[model samples]
Target: MKTDVTPATVRDWFSEQPAGKLFTMPTISAIFGVAPGDERRRLAEAVRCGYLCGFLERTETASGRAYRVSGKGMRRPTLEEGDRARRKAEARLARDDRKRRARGAPVSPNKSSRVRAARVSLRAANMPVPATAVQHSVCETVEQFLARGGRVQRLTAHWEQMEQAA
Candidate 1:
């Protein structure tokens, strides 16, 4: 009898396997009656979900990448649990986005113009101008630093003090 191949079924199979018994992708595909080509793609997604949901543990072996059942019991994660995980991940990402924006460059109409002028002046002085992406990154960093009431001072004296101590 042909068994239905699904993420839950795959998870169950992994859970049934003895702990630490490694099974590679091809071995799994064959055991689950998963065909090559398009069917393999679906199986791969199922395996990925199993890994993500903590139903399986992946590791590298001498043969290749392999997976085994997680020591965490056979209890399947519910739909609500999956949704909660998704929400938590989204909230973390949003928090990170806010932090990045808080530390990012101030939005100003003349910001690009100022960056362009700086690059032009550097080139005119025969100094190697940084690439456009790097120039923007440096400009943002400097703007953020200055906006925070920070000042740039030559660190030569500090370095000389450290050198004398050494």
Candidate 2:
């Protein structure tokens, strides 16, 4: 079986597989090309995590066991779940990319301008930015200040207090 799972492959398997039950490993592996070892386990985990479901009778085969998606609670995924999942995944990827960039690793160019600015500010200082700026990300503010040739300066307690009074 192949190691990669594609939409076309999954579609083909679902068509041949009885509706309403979950698919078994060998059947899935045959369609998607999952390896017999860790790959198979990983694919199974995807099913267990509710990404896939089974409903057909469990059957033993020479390779391993498998099940069908039982139609009882089966329904197509809703747009809300799909959208929310996509958003969450995108957020997670963005966060990971930020962490990577912070560590001097390469990242994609599609990152938002605000996110980029915040990254710059965070790298330059350890201070906690105000919540309003944090929600927008600190990157833009840092970039704006830097673009104006302004530099961050540490303030002594007295100076900070005096500035606040003024």
Candidate 3:
């Protein structure tokens, strides 16, 4: 039987291995509940915790995330510009949507310009197309980040920092 190698799949794999021994965010995301591409923040947190570095390499992909165990302080390559832009736009949409929901406001009908732009690019590529598909694409993008060891400090802390930075 072909086993499902999803976030849950990767999480199960890592959980089965051992705790506290440099598991990449992708593995954690696959098993855990985080979206892909969002793993960058998780990786940052792991880096803060001294758990990950160049050694624990992970990479984001169009479909999902992937990872492998590695030594301490291992620095893998960074995301390309296009990929980074895609991630940022998706994250912004997710954050804004969450905020809108929390405020008990009606959800916005149209996606942010960033998301629209991304959709346009995706469409131009002649990829299987869908108009309202940005949200799912964002989810997949977050999964990619997760695979690449993304991290998010608790959402509350993140919001506070954003407020202050703003």
- The numbered model that scores best in lDDT is 1
Q: Model 3: how far is 49 from its true place, Å? A: 9.8
Question: Which candidate number has the best TM-score?
Answer: 1
- Candidate 1 Cα outliers beyond 4 Å, as residue runs: 73-76, 80-166
Tell me how candidate 1 scores on lDDT: 0.79
What's the candidate order when arranged by decreasing TM-score?
A: 1, 2, 3
Residue-level lDDT for 150 in candidate 3: 93
> Which regions of candidate 2 deviate over 4 angstroms?
1-12, 18-23, 35-46, 49-65, 73-76, 79-86, 89-166
lDDT of 2 by residue, 1-61 (tens): 4645533344445556656554566666666677688777766655543334332345565
- TM-score of model number 3: 0.25
Q: For candidate 2, give the lDDT.
A: 0.62
State each model's CA lDDT, in order. Answer: 0.79, 0.62, 0.55
Ten residues in sequence with the least summed lDDT for candidate 3: 1-10
Stretches > 4 Å off in candidate 3: 1-77, 109-166
- Residues 76-121, model 1: lDDT tens digits: 6556768979998989977876776688944333577699989988
Candidate number with the higher TM-score (1 or 3) = 1
lDDT tens digits by residue: candidate 3, 1-166: 1244333334335445543454444455444455556454564454333324343455555645445444343354445789979999999998998999899987765658569878889889987657773454324567677788997565568779999999
Residue 9 displacement in candidate 2 (angstroms): 6.0
What number of clashing residue pairs does each candidate have, in the order they appear? 0, 26, 35
